[model samples]
Target: MLLKRAIGVAAGAAVVTAILVAPASGAGQADLDSAVREAMLAERGAAASADFGTPVLAEPLVEPTRSNDQGWAFGTTTIPAPDVEHAGPHTAIFVAHRQAQGWQVELDGTAEFVEAVERAPADVVSEGEKQLFARNYENSRVAVADTGLGLPWAEGVAWWMGGGPHGDSGQSRPFSSLDFNGGNGQVLSAGAGRVYKSCLRNGSGLVRVVHENGFSTTYYHMTGLTDLGDGQPVAYGDYLGRIDVGLPCGGSTTGPHVHFSLLRGDSHTKVDGQTIGGWTFREGAQAYGGYAERNGTQVGTGGRITNHGQGTSTPTGVVESGQNTSVNVRSEPRLSAPVVDELPDGSVVRIKCTARGDFVDGVWGRTDLWNQRDVGGWISDGFLYTGSDGPIAPAC
Candidate 1:
């Protein structure tokens, strides 16, 4: 099944775009991801057209979700960043299994709109391609010195499960020592990239490499090491530094382990320091190239086909849609009240309530229906098909 690939992001939105800044060292995890997402959206939007519609929430929505097996929650709505949508904000989402391809996809708001999440490249290493695989086991502990089974590089699900920590239980016995055949703190490249950042006074707290493909992989918590000039390019598996399990020099870690991460394009997707292996530990970004030509016109809390006649919403700030969709509204946007009945996607929601800002949740923009204000919550801006009627397109 091959479809025409469309351009990403809006046409010529590069004006309000922000710059990408790599953290020196000790950069906060949240800050890192935010920078990456914004840059990607800007790029994607440049090529974006009206073909794909982004789901906009009246408010933000946060819920627990499964990214790989990490079981981390995320904000469902994903808006395109100002400058790029073609590059897209680095995000992860659970694709519905109904698609038959067995490939995961970006689950934006409506399930009906998805075609495919991730399509494998022509030469992608499929299952039958490799006969037998040897797990790169340094000491039999998953996250310590583990590499892809009999492979040098890894991506997607295989990397999420293999690269991070694993045990019998969440509190299983730790590995006493991995294979003595290699260095402990010896950091290898998570992927090919240049040294965007080095061990500095205050940064991601380790050496950060920016790959050619805009991905950034970090080698965190180093104890002993020599200095390499920042921005120096290196191959995969290059020596970064050594780590002592007992030290907390750079970003504090429980034991000696290199904190690895993958930042798609924009080069600075932050890794929240809690350290959940495999899954990128960030939300999957879902952005469209342009406004989903809405014919039915999603009615806001004003009940009429208007922004209360105050002109259409002219948001000045960035609206994040991926895992940290703090800008979405979950309840109905009919009136200044909460929704009483539980409605799924595609349900005709009457604007029973409309409260400016947020009510229950802390989303920046929230709205409620008038009739059902009790169980009714924020209508989440990132839903497919605004207002009440239309040609029924897929949500991004």
Candidate 2:
């Protein structure tokens, strides 16, 4: 799975989701019709956009349209020490509407939302007057690979060093840094930014470079440490060094390795890396990519988008909501049950439903028309916003 494999390369990110409705029982078919009607009644006209984050459950997430109603998977673990890895248990999730105040969680027949929160501490994130911040956060994380195995981690893609394949796929390591095992390299941005990081490690020798995206790539334990350093800048396929850092890290990792990590600071602490001291950059991707300890903890990672399907309209006949509709209606106040279907512009499709509603995408809202049978595989919010002044920017 994308998420499973992504765990092997810690340089990337993850996502999560939430349930806003309460279910009658743990094992019962969700009332899609009722939910749709409620959403339709509650969601109408125009509305402003609001920010969101990972959600905590207040109750069981019932689903009649989706295959499974509740389930969760393990995500990446932070390596606290050389041999210690921390992990959370399998989680259950769902989208719910209306429940008794505060937040609630349903584990089997257990009812304990407030108790869970009291046991665990969290950071505060508010979106003005909107009390829906928690819901957005939970919803956003749902689409991410971090929550489940089948999610999109941008995971397990081939390692392409350009026109040809690099090494034998995941077998290749970095040229230096040789300090860990079992995909133990850290993906560091020589500095900080909303920058994206790349994976490039070989078990030969010293290999590291900074990219324009505020990310860094380094290979360790190689038979080399390329002369590039200090104010050096490199990309995914660039050669930083050759593998063979003697056999220090461990046996599972032969030769050298690239100790990749995303630095919380702005640049490499040491430049030359010539055993004694190295060069350093004052600013830019170079300074950030340079070697250095993380100055702080990761505030947060990737996020999912909310107020999705905003500003679009589509007709919703008796078809299932969230499903694809033949007629593309960009509507606001996204309603469930009448799953919407949308075809690329110019595609031929018969009218399905003419439901009038508004969608909230960030700060924009569009009308919507959901198809009865085609909403599951519908285009992502990414493809939905093809044109328009602001385009479709999700509130992830």
Candidate 3:
């Protein structure tokens, strides 16, 4: 099954509903609800303009989760689309900030909310609070390796890999998402992390987990979500919600299955050749064309792969040159090799393969392993941040 991207439109109106969950003591639920309504109305108007056909909004399944002394509120609301016969209501995730004028609301996943926190006045938000929020935002952007993620289901359960490694934005490049079905339709967290709900209608929507190790995961078209407030912590294998044909964010699903996606920072990272749940995923020549290999067994697309549990590190790294402008990329693994280019610090790179070569004491320490870049040439793995002291990619 292919998953679609959500359309974002913003306009203005007014609608208020009762708080589905209790807010923090002293927080003004009415004011928050009113602000959210305004944002929703604007979104609906935008949707209408985009030919969504008089978009209909439902009361939030629960009160928007609040933090920083109620200075911030985030939650989901449903947009029922009667015109779309095969799809369910499209859900929207929103973030609202309390300003001197009023509550300012915007769609989540954008930088506006985070930037607002960064630019918040000291009088309105304390220094410590600002730092806390800033750290959270940074965590979402930084990429980490060896996140130790597994299948998005319970252990020992056999699930059909209906769609192999594919792009999160439909059938596109960077095959980073997988579709799975079976095991009671229950979707579980692949690892432990903070949970945030986005795109909700009635009660079904998408769930994202920002893993402690810096990687994140998103589960879309899910139903029966728990009453999880934003930023709630969840353990690995925790039941998040159920997979169904709920198109809370305007996606079409042939049947009930969770579109499990692996994310590094805000964008989806390719899962090809990455080992998860004891099976290594190999991307297909085309979208949704790949196989998961475990032991001597190779399960192709549309086949069932058992959740063997646990994950293996993938061949990826970030460039790091302490106190230097860029790290040198050579035609060969040796430092004496001709310099082909310079990789700027903090730049993420794909490790095509690796080979043992001339050792050098680099920022991460001395290593003989040299990483072959996807583009061409080689660089010291020590200078590459692969979250491992040794090599991670295949041998050259």
Candidate 4:
């Protein structure tokens, strides 16, 4: 949707006035999405269209994590662009207030938004909410030195260190992340804190955990994520999500693995010389070229590392066909493929990922999307309800 805005003088300062349509009172997700898009376009002007194209919200709207009785709301949104320069989506932390005219959006990093949050009355914004926003603001500006985080899996489980220390943005500097594969596929909370989902759309998204020490961790390329709401508390070893090749935030991966990174506030911090999951990371003078050491055992990239964090059970979902029948599991995505087994209606399924194949009309309507089960072969997604009309898992 095309949006227009005017930069005008208000009280001798710059203020953004929406020239396009404004969201009415009690706006829904689509309205808020347009508001965010307008704010972004106003800030970037024509450059936004030339570079990133039109911004699209990654997920449907949920309840505001920070809001008050005065119709003031604060939350974050992920706008995934088609541009390739950014490894992921652009995260927008915005403040919205309802006025006699309409809803207005003010993004972070602006003087007006900062002052408004700081001086907001107790009734408008609670003390705890203010502190949380302050922490988020501070973390984005400063780099954290260390954290007490551990592996994002169960204790004593061996996981392959597919890629060594690398940039969280898939670049060279700020080696803030490491990739892990070949475990139970269950990703657990590294520490106790609150969890939030980003770039979530059609049942797929990335997870972030904010710890008590003002440190946060990011988990990417995951599927079958938790249903927990934003700002929900989680204990160490709680089930966060499952590792997959899914790129819900716009990126590419070779296999099913989790890109784990530590953050101080919102900024990615270097993992070099930092101890995590009982191993110390050392950079190898190049990205994806590092080794982890623990008690005289040196594990280089492609080696397996023992997880010392708490573990959780694998997540599974039931296959729904509506009719009291079964669906054939094919050896390949096509219906012509040989049938290997059959899954009874309402049977549990551990789905690995999805792939394009023959279109089938079944319980959930017709679609060409097929789901590959962890146990073996493929099944028509039309027969299995995964909570979305579109593909929820990564491409297989």
Candidate 5:
């Protein structure tokens, strides 16, 4: 289900003047601007503090545009860092939708809002087109590896079957539900990645992690949670939370069990067509009936698996101090690969893949500085430490 959180608008006659005035199908630039300003004011007032004064929107919102197919508009705004709670400049994307009365604040956040906007087209367009676009994007960005996944629970923990291989029935998608023998069990991340969402609300508690390889794994029906926040990096075998069977955590579950689902992409909209370790995930399939093998060895099954090799070809590494204080990120994987950007000491980067390059100190590691625009190149493995021994990440 799409989680909708209502934005609180301050009640006042002056505030009413800022209400959005737009057509039924689309919002004009003036309406969008008014909506953005009003939403920012409300958000700032809600986050105000005496020590920090009042948070004000930085002038000149970025990427102010209306939705192509809906009565919605969005803009990215910058909030200057203050002296109190929020100490750094923060960026937010605000969304406003038209209503019978006027335009109102709908949603605001970072990538999540971006995703919501992307999915809005599906509401007006054909579902087939949406699925096709999703598949195309997945094929372009994702390359599944043959690494086995670690079973989410600890060893010797016997879990009963709560649900298995369900089809797309309402809110439930393709997933397996493992019921804890004692009404609860420890839930662990299926692989190493960043915690995308740790949302617990509306009778549902879940954790979604985006793996280095562009795939995402979700664990739902959790009760106790770890201290991991959104966008926090997590290592393989990290404990996420505990499973619970009842309401407020496990949404509409009959028993206490963790619902696990491997996805093809980071967004929830791209959950279909998931393929892990070369096995295509199917709806209504048995959780334990399927099997995956690596080099003729039975490594994982549909139900239980290890996080051994279930990641993308890209490996995450940190920029260590080389002969220089910073490393030059190039457009390609060689010394002559045209420097695109520079990475300071202790900077974390994702190595898209290794390439046989101009050997420097017996190292030939290459990476694409994905986070930085116009930055990508190869760095010597001598300066890039992947925390893992040998090259477990796939070759480019």
Candidate 6:
């Protein structure tokens, strides 16, 4: 019922799980158990940190249906809180699809996952099953813009702060404004899109660009717009205007900075789903709040943006296994460059920037790694699974 309201969809659709006839095989059950345990650990860990208390398995995990050639598995787990005075056991439905490497938990939230499962076909024996799997698979995939986005400012400008609630009003909202550090500077488009400047308000000098993915990025408190007219196509990093300070821009602020907001579907929706520089938007949340995820890792509570340096990357990464037990971190983006450090398997490092380098074993792009002391060096991009859009940092 909550899911139906959230998605604005009617309920009473015949229960799909009820119609599931074929049962999961033995090996499939084993894989399902393993995946369920992994999901439980992740979900419970998150819940515990939020003071939700540790959740105990209320009931045995149940497989909803059998898988086809698509190598999909569906199940549900009910977790009950120790303190029953607050709420009942929460049931989390999940779907895991077998990837080339192993089984990956695709969807595992309560409402969202249940909605996906409920949307599956009631009759799992025929073509409807195929349709259900297809829909679930698509929903499991992350939504990303067709074209990659770059920092709105020019390379090396270093004009960013940790993302948080930012707007003209100063109230908590989605998006972030890069602190201009007092002076007006050139503003650029974050990605390729169509430009619109008609809705300027409060002397905000707003410029809105709609990307190919139906999401629009708006730049506020800017002046001296480019000669480009509304509906004109602009490429990523295209000059937009100059950051300005005036009453026309809705909010009061200390210095001139470009106010930026990314809207999906339309300007009204302010959900936290968009990602910039691996930092996901956190609508109505503080900077480094619980909502944002950096490179697939949840930035826990009390996290703050330390330094907004040029070519700096956030979210940590581990040196994965394969090929070599360890990789050399060079002072520069070249094989002949001096070795600055060595990252062993499982060593955690922050990816700083990327550069094209000599092909080593099949890796051509090199990623700059930052150690605990903020020392920087380059390593092969092949060995790191950043869990984000390839490389988030700008080219060095």
The lDDT per prediction is: 0.28, 0.22, 0.66, 0.66, 0.45, 0.47
Better of 2 and 3 by lDDT: 3
Ranking by TM-score: 4, 3, 6, 5, 1, 2
Best by lDDT: 4
Candidate 1: misplaced stretches above 4 Å? Answer: 1-183, 202-204, 245-251, 267-396
Clashes of each: 84, 149, 4, 1, 14, 7
Show the lowest summed lDDT stretch of 10 residues, model 3: 1-10
lDDT of 4 by residue, 1-396 (tens): 112245666899887556433566566556666765566545533322333334442332322456676767766665454434335444545566655545566654444555556666665555654565566555556544335566888754567898898876556357888988876799998887777777776556778776666567778878899888776678888998888877766757778888888766434678898777667788778878889875455789998776543211221334666765888999999989999998887675666778999999877788999888888799888887543456545577
The deviation in Å at residue 253 for candidate 1 is: 1.7
Candidate 3 regions off by >4 Å? Answer: 1-64, 67-71, 75-145, 295-297, 312-396
Off by over 4 Å in 4: 1-31, 38-69, 81-86, 99-145, 309-396
Q: What is the TM-score of each candidate against the true structure?
A: 0.25, 0.19, 0.53, 0.58, 0.37, 0.39
Give the TM-score comparing model 3 with the true structure, all chains together: 0.53
lDDT for each residue of candidate 5 in 1-396, tens digit (9 for 90 to 100): 233232454664223233344444444666666655555555443442221244343432334433544565544443333323212222344455566655665333233344554655543323442343344344436453342344455422223334334421122333322222231377777666556332234444456665544445666557667776444568766888877652332124555666665544322222223434222333334433333332233322223322222433333556666567887776766677687677777665665555556655523244431222113565566665443334434566
Q: What's the residue-level lDDT of 26 in candidate 1?
A: 43
What lDDT tens digits, residue by residue, belong to model 2 across residues 1-396? Answer: 010000111346333233233445542334432332233222210010000011211121122212222222111101011111110011112122223321122211012221222232222111220122223233332322111111000111111111111111111211111122222122222221111111112433223332322223333334433444333343332334332333222223323333332210121222212110011111112211222111121111111111101012321111112333333433332444343445533242222222323342321233332222233322222223222222122221
**After superposition, which runs of candidate 6 have C-alpha atoms over 4 Å from their true positions?**
1-147, 155-157, 172-184, 199-204, 271-273, 283-396
lDDT of 3 by residue, 182-242 (tens): 8588899898766777666667777877675546688877889967666667888898999
Q: Cα deviation of 374 in candidate 6 (Å)?
A: 20
Q: How would you encode candidate 6's per-residue C-alpha lDDT over 1-396 as one tens digit per residue?
A: 211111111484423111112224544666666655555444443332232233343432433444556666654443333332122122334555554444554343233443444544433223432333344334334475321445576532334343344432233233233233221378888777666563243444457665654445667657777778544678877899887753232234445666666554312234355455445545544432344455344443333221112122444445564777787777776678899888787665665556666655523234433222135777666655443335445555
Candidate 3 lDDT score relative to the true structure: 0.66
